[model samples]
Target: MTTSTKQRPEPMSVRRRTPAWAKAVIALVAVLAVLFAGLRLSVLPGLRDLFGMDTHDRSGPVLLRSIQDMSRYEAASGTFQVVVDLERDSKYLPSAIRGTRTLYVGAGTVDAYVDLGRVGRQDVTVDADRTSATLRLPHAALGKPTLDPDRSYAVSKQRGLLDRIGDLFSDNPNSERAVQKLAVRHIGEAAKESELTARAETNTTAMLDGLLKSLGFKEVKVSYGT
Candidate 1:
């Protein structure tokens, strides 16, 4: 009866449980590491805040902006121009096909109204002859402000009101460098980058197609204005 009774303990070996495909491969590696950390922390800053100020880049699909003539306005009296033409299509997104003071064309007024007893107004200006491509007007100050119905004075002593407020702020830096250069040139022409451009150079198919060819109505055909 000595050690023979201890053999009963060998029948107690029952340790089995823990494999449902190894707990489904550890829950599929913790759901692919929580989907790659939610695509590196919330989908890359929501796409850089709807894409803007990424500095832009297209390398060379064409981007040129080299106009000049800005020296304290070179003697400002209204005739400071630096224009060009050629834009099959543009609506702003990241522009620079050209800049540095653009107004391709504007500030054109040829109004002539007079009658001393009341109504009075005179103006005729169209400037921009960047070395000669034609476009400079004033016709000798429109013939020295014609309206001589027995002149006595009141044309603000020959165009005054501080010279019409310095000719209406002298084209305010050429219409604010042509709207900050057409809003930095089409900011990518769309698809993103904060989209908001395409004023298409003051609508009407480019300002009434260069103002109906400077009113000569050069084969008119521009109706866009939305």
Candidate 2:
């Protein structure tokens, strides 16, 4: 009887290195993640966005700042007409959601003009040196509690009245409308970026509050379309 000596199986040697394809995939994934991180954290914050910094919340302070900045440019002798159109977004229907304004600032940046739907339209002209400012408004679109230079520069009712007054004089408020286009074409340029867009839309709302203190407007009437 030949006793069969059981030969112990040689210990198996296993290689621990990761698969080549898996290594390549891991490297690629790592590179992409680094690039994405750089963009999200470093590259985007200071990129001079026309619409101001990105806001997670749409209805935030960016709109107000844009308007204020435009006004500052006006007060500084920059001739430009900023058109704040409350144009309806065709996609967003059934509700009047105030969309971006198209700012049409003129050359020299001295004059600025914009249309604020409920507040009415305005045309502002400031001297090159920022000394004097002239605003033209149609007498028809005036709203209540308007500034009354005719009444008194120290207007009792001009409290919180700066939003709609920039348009001075009895001139053609929307003259650009008749000759085949709005006045924007003749001005500096249309604000194509989101930054100026916000300003154009909200300029009326911000300026009106401040103008009340300066007696900047002569009259303001609501519900009038002119």
Candidate 3:
């Protein structure tokens, strides 16, 4: 106890600190790794899309037969313009409650033609002297009407309250198709009433007369089949 007990101070512990540059290097490496991973994911998908590898083709080829032996000669043409009003409703009591209406304006042309193939060799008579000829042509027929897509358009449409709800549950009526059909029918009727057949016959006669006259025939006669 008398011996001045000098308490020996315990050796101070020393903690080593990492350098600032090393911390910065570690942070930079981590950022580079993240960027590299992002680039890999984005570039692979981009390349696939660019090369169309990610897309699927769901359509196949369509083939059609070639049309042959069709000799079409237009003899007359008629243009008709009309407005069609189409109305449809569910049958029975529902018709009064649920009705639909559509109006459309359509313009179209009807062409008339004569089939030359129907003419037989006997139908054409050439005099022995080759100075006169008589040609018999077939009757005129109406071709399919061609609608003007640009001019044809729906003018108005109306759907009743109940009809609107019914459309949600049932298939909707095709107003455009109905209107188109009506247009065709109306145009055809008008064309027939306009004497398109008579015009076609007249035109055909003139055409044949001119052609035969050009062939050194002094007299040419053209007649149409009944």
Candidate 4:
């Protein structure tokens, strides 16, 4: 029988099946990756827009704007701090229902401007020799004061037991708005007393005087309307 006894092939080891949990984990990982990719793509446009990345330098004006803003005076008022006491009581038993007191502080700014666009043909007169010029302008007026909502805040709030109990059920939404209004009123009054109009007038005169001199006029005169 000689040397060659047929050698039987070693039995092939059976491949182990993957565990259910392991397969599930792999599937979950794949699903999460896909979802994450989709979410990133979804917010890409918003991110780009927020950062102004979608804009280009191709500039064009579709229409010529006639009106212009010549902001001559920027009058900022001093901070106004006040405490407001608010009371809302039952019509019959006024003392039984107590109220709240709030301390509010606010600041604002007012602007004064001259609109050159409003000047009429007759408003400007150039002397025959072109050595003198006169310009008539409108009177300086106060702009609406804008309350800085960010800087304005409620310093403190004092609420009675009754008020607290009532607040649990309903909230007073108008309190903050009321505070802002009060601050704006005080700022407006303060700005009116700041002589901003006179400052604006002086600035306007100086500005025109320089402009006329630059244009070779020996004498320049500026007048304001009532």
Candidate 1 — which residues are off by over 4 angstroms?
Answer: 1-6, 25-27, 34-58, 64-226
| Tens digit per residue, CA lDDT, model 1, 1-226 | 5666554555667899879999899998787557434444336777656664557666866667798643121111211112222233234432333112222421221112111122113222233532212221121111011122232111111222333235446755223343334332332221122211122212323543475477654443422111
Clash tally for model 1? 15
Q: Which runs of model 4 end up more than 4 angstroms from their true locations?
A: 1-96, 170-175
Question: Following a full C-alpha superposition, what root-mean-square deviation does model 1 have from the true structure?
Answer: 26.0
lDDT tens string, model 2, 1-226?
A: 6898999999999979999999999998787556434344335565445445655756745454343322122211222333333232335432222222233322213223343322323555555655455555322211111111222121111111111122224275333232213333433233332244334324544565356426654443222134
Report the candidate with higher lDDT, 1 versus 2: 2
Candidates by lDDT, descending order:
3, 4, 2, 1
1 against 3, candidate with superior lDDT: 3
lDDT of every predicted structure (CA atoms):
0.32, 0.37, 0.82, 0.71
Flag the better candidate by lDDT, 2 or 4: 4
Give the TM-scores of the predictions, in the order they appear: 0.17, 0.20, 0.66, 0.58
Which is superior by lDDT, 2 or 3?
3
lDDT of 3 by residue, 10-109 (tens): 9999998989999999998787557434454345767655655456889989787686887656899988999999888876646546787889999999
lDDT score of model 4?
Answer: 0.71
Best candidate according to TM-score: 3
Error of 3 at 99 (Å): 0.4
User: lDDT, candidate 4, residue 203?
Assistant: 83
User: Which candidate ranks first by lDDT, i.e. highest?
Assistant: 3
Return the TM-score for candidate 2, rounded to 2 decimals: 0.20
Q: Give the TM-score (vs. native) of candidate 3.
A: 0.66
